[model samples]
Target: MLTITLAQADGSWENPEQIRGAVAAFVKAHLPGNAAQAHVAVQGPAPGLRFPACRQMRMGFFGYSNPYGNQTVAVTCTTPSAWTIYIPVQLVMNQAVVVAARPLGAGTLLAADDLSIIRRNASNLAGSAVVDPQLAVGQVLRFGVAAGQPILASMLDAPEVVHAGQEITLIAEGDGVRISTIAKAMENGRPGQTILVRNSSSGKVIRGTVDQAGAVLVPF
Candidate 1:
């Protein structure tokens, strides 16, 4: 089993057992298959975690190595009650294997398929309220440093939808007037392109151009 050591960043611990239990629960809920790969070791002073708490979370393959040797990512809680944790999968993996015999290397920009790559890619936050989830593979996600930050992710690419009766600016202005019109299903118009906007109330389809803001404008 891979041993995951949970330590405070500033070196303090309030309750080591509580931290360990939280980590264990998070792993069971998110990564059931990879439970055997984890063995948590808590070492630090009492009253650990001041601004935020931390817990060493792990799953799947638990072997990370580099010139600094093997290191597991710790799920950190910025506050004692906030329910979010920054999962830095790509960053930790890349740093851990930088000078190793086989480097993990940097990955491509996050897209809609790398969710699973972040399940165990976090560091810090064990006793706090932030509960980590099992991310999917090939899923798109965005991240940054700083405590309690949000990492946005999405699986499917959705198209923009436009409703009828809303006033929209048009790109094609023949006689000035700024070409404003009510549109229906014409929300699919491309910028600087002409499209047909059907008025929801009148059921009239007027031709107009899409403005820089993607709004369809039609002059009366």
Candidate 2:
């Protein structure tokens, strides 16, 4: 076995480099994805920081360490059982995400012309930042958004495709056959929303999903 020796401070024993290396290894193993760059920043304890050095040092986290942002890491001496210290680390993660191209009001539909892609520092952005333009486009805003703002998942929703009291064509398909009927929507709904509709011919209410063409699909 090859024994690697780490350079230690004179008489005092503080292997800050070892701690940094350990944290780096841990971050590298946990970082997700190949597109974004992951970086872990850790500084050794202050020069005056005094503690008994142990042959075995272990690094632990206070909670789950985020892939990005500041974290408190625990460095402990397992063999000596003398002392433990916490180190503050900052992780910088940069990634690409979609942003609004123009100011949009609530209930505004997001189209391809309303979105742009750019590289950004995601540290300050919410966890719901939309990464794909396709996910943001064709969705309606739950709240107003400023131009150049990062589009968050919580800010968008599917716009209502069917409105209450509106007449819509209902299609029923079964066993490779299709049937069409007239129905009146009882409630507003989006493309995938299920709502009750009254069939004009049968005069009976049935459950169906709103379709893109202002129609409803009811399965037998």
Top TM-score model: 2
The top-ranked prediction according to lDDT is: 2
Tell me model 2's lDDT, rounded to 2 decimals.
Answer: 0.76
**Tens-digit lDDT string for candidate 2 (9-112):** 34556566666676666555656675246667776676677775556666667676665566767777665445677777776667788988989899988899
**What's the lDDT for all of these models?**
0.37, 0.76
- All models, RMSD in angstroms: 16.4, 4.3
lDDT of 1 by residue, 1-220 (tens): 3333445544443354554455444433333242334343323223533334444433332344221122333544433333322221221211110011121123323333222122332333221111222232232222232222323232211222333445554333555544344446554644555567776566777777565565766555
Q: Estimate each model's TM-score.
A: 0.22, 0.76
